[model samples]
Target: MAFSNPFQTYQKQAVSTSRPEELTYMLYQGLVKYIRIAKNSLENKNFEESNTFILRSQDILSELMITLKTGYPVTDSLLSMYDYMKARLIQANINKDQQILEEVETYAVELSETWYNAMKEMKIKN
Candidate 1:
């Protein structure tokens, strides 16, 4: 018999049960985490691990772009930001540059915080 990790199971449940706004916040959080890991790994001279994490962060950006609604005026700006971040991640991965990773991490953190605040305000209004 195989054993499943409780934390992994819990994370799966959390994601499965989360509302769309919550999922967006989670994605932003994930992007920040992966970028941070990639930066740390790069600083430690772990190129392979850094590359893997960078790719993961890029995937999150792609997912965000795909799921974004087009009717909103802000959609274009958000898409542009996601594209820029993904490009920065590619540059960081290719050059093994921690500075570039830091730049993306800053954007990710800001976006995550903004999303969290919006969710909070939504809850209060409803």
Candidate 2:
């Protein structure tokens, strides 16, 4: 019998049960996490590992972009921000620049904070 990793199983369950807003919050969390690890790897002069992490974070940003609903003014602004972030990530990966990763991390933090607070407000109002 193949033993499944408990953490992986738990993560799949958590995702399956989460609401849309919760999933968005989770994506932001993952993005920030990947960016931080990439930054650390870059700082340590581990270029290959940094590239892998940055690409993983970029994929999350792409997912966020793909799922954005149309007809809302906020969506346009968010699209722009996501595009900028992805571009910055590409540049950071190519250059192996820790500073660029830090800048991207700041944006990720802002996005996650704003998203989380908005969700909390929505919950209270509902």
Candidate 3:
């Protein structure tokens, strides 16, 4: 018999039960986290770890971009922002630039906060 980590199990259940808005919030949080880790790794001179984290952040951005629904006015703007962030991540990864990572982190943080607020407003309405 194999044992699973309790935290991992809890996380899986949480994600499985979350609404789409919650999932988007989670992704934004993840993007910020990966960017922060990449920045720290770069600061520590860990090129490989930094590269890996930056790539993870870019993947999250790609996921966000692909999941956007069509016919919404905001969708196009959000897609553009995601594309810009991914480009910055690529530049950060290539140059190992902490400043570029910080810029992306700023955007990720803002998006995460905005999403959280929107969720709150939605819950209030419902």
Q: For candidate 2, what is the lDDT?
A: 0.96
The lDDT for every candidate, in the order shown, is 0.94, 0.96, 0.95
lDDT of 2 at 123: 89
Off by over 4 Å in 2: none
Instruction: Tell how far residue 40 is off in model 1, in angstroms.
Output: 0.3
**73: Cα error in model 2, Å:** 1.1
> Where does candidate 2 have its weakest 10-residue lDDT segment?
93-102
Using Cα atoms with residue i matched to residue i, what is each candidate's TM-score against the true structure?
0.97, 0.98, 0.97
Candidate 3 error regions (>4 Å): none
lDDT for each residue of candidate 3 in 1-126, tens digit (9 for 90 to 100): 999999999999999999999999999999999999999999999999999999999999999998999678899899989999999999999888899999999999999999999999999999
Q: Model 1: clashing residue pairs?
A: none
Model number with the top TM-score = 2
- Ten contiguous residues with the weakest lDDT in model 3: 70-79
